[model samples]
Target: MSDLPLDQVRTLLAVVDEQSFDRAAAVLHVTPSAVSQRVKALEQRLGRVLILRTKPVRLTGSGQVVVRFARQLTRLEEDTRAELGLVGAAEPVTLPIAVNADSLATWFLPALAAVPAVGSAPAVAFDLHSEDQDHTATLLREGLVMAAVTSAPNPVQGCTSARLGRMRYRAVASPAFVARWLTDRPLPEALPAAPAVLFGRKDELQDRFLRGLTRRGATGVRHFVPSSESFVDAVAAGLGWGMVPELQHRADELVDLAPDHPADVPLYWQQWKLDSPALATVAAAVVAAAATALRQ
Candidate 1:
């Protein structure tokens, strides 16, 4: 077995996490030269170029593997301390997680609140990274977060997954916009001619729904408002029509153009395989909340 130095591995992780050798050196209380030498030693021992030294350094594929190992090592160290009663009794459990923005606006906060209180332990604190359901798992793969709610069924390496449920979406627009733009015409003909709002350039949910309705894909006449709240607001302001989550629309004056035609996107929760009590508590709370809020 090739002996890998723990300090070198940790130094590599610090570089990736801080994204700068100088910053990592400050955190480690070592000179930047020492940090650089340690990473070089690690790369030599592993026989791979681990990091791409750029402004805000980036990990190569090999570096990602080492970074993941470093995170798992940290987690295991913490678990060992807790199991041996080495940590203070009232220490807070920090869980870093990735979730979609729509769920954050609707169900995720309540789920965190539902975690059962532990006796005298500091309240569980979450470091949440918000992204789309389709992309949240990338955070898990990079060891940036311990868990994620995603649209992917395939689990990330060293992770376990369970289906949460589906979030239903409906195509909606302001009544005024529809009257002016869609009245007295077939939906397929009118929809293509009208303006539209999108969550982002990558978002295809609205286009996919439109394709189902019109037997043709959505037009290029679109405005991209990336945030979930802003995208819905843009639709309500009649900037354009678009798909909005059912849960986010109740208080708005927006009208569903195709109430009978809604799209359901499946969601799943995936977490690291480590048996962390804090992770378990959060997972249970999220599952329970999803059961109540998402369509099963």
Candidate 2:
């Protein structure tokens, strides 16, 4: 611990955050050569290579550990500054978090709205990243975000997770779309032949929903709509049928493919196990908002 220097550690973090050695130097107000030297020194001291030579500079596993430590150190310093009442308007406390696109388009922003300290209110700013619910926790693992809305119930190492209820999705389609495709046959049989919408190339909600009904993955013409709003809009525009979140607008009376059952993705809030009040405040607001917006 004593051998590891703060300057080198902070330099490594800056390089990762800035995505380039030269840019890291710009942020730290040091020469680019100095930045490189510090990173090299740190790697030698730790006996590990941290950053890859990629354009954006990818972090190795060892790099992730060091970056996480650096972020936590910054967080602690900010907390201490706030506690000592030394924080001024010049620098706001930054709280970075990851959220699913669906939640971000719906309840997550409202939850943040209730918290005065999360954005523009107090000396605080938010670094919000949108990710899929199933994968948001990976941001926390990579030390990219302090908290995340994830589908995983199990907390990441050195973190805690709390249930935030479930967001239900219903297989829905435009009235015209249903009449053109699904109405001609049973859903299990027709859904396979019908045009479908996907959240992204990685999306499998439609496939999963189909699998639940037919024990087979969705097939036939498929369109990938990556934007949360656009995905729902495409379904309403009759581009394709898809699993739409209950919160999104229904331009047409949605024929719930399975009225008796819905796809419910349970959500959880995961944050680093920290003593900082800012994280707790945001977590509390998120949980409170979920109680009203999601199924218990």
Badly placed stretches (over 4 Å) of model 1 are 89-91, 116-123
User: lDDT of each model, Cα atoms only?
Assistant: 0.85, 0.87
Residue 253 shift from truth in candidate 2, angstroms: 5.5
lDDT of 2 by residue, 1-296 (tens): 54679999899989987889999999999999999999999899889898897998988999888888888888888988887878887877899899999999999999987887453333557899988888899889988889999999999998999999999998888888889998877888988888998888767777778888899776679998889999988988889888999998583556666777589999999999988877777888899999999999
| Candidate 2 stretches greater than 4 Å from native | 117-122, 251-253
Candidate 1 C-alpha error for residue 177, in Å: 1.6
Q: Ten-residue segment with the worst summed lDDT in candidate 1?
A: 116-125
- What TM-score fits each model? 0.91, 0.94
Of the candidates shown, which would achieve the greatest lDDT relative to the real structure? 2
For model 1, residues 1-296, the per-residue Cα lDDT tens digits are: 22679999999888877889999999999999999999999999989999999988877878877887787777677666766777675765677799988899889899998785532233466889988888999888977788999999999989999999999998889988989898989888889778999888778788789778888876648898989888888988889898889888854589888878999999999999986766777888899999999999
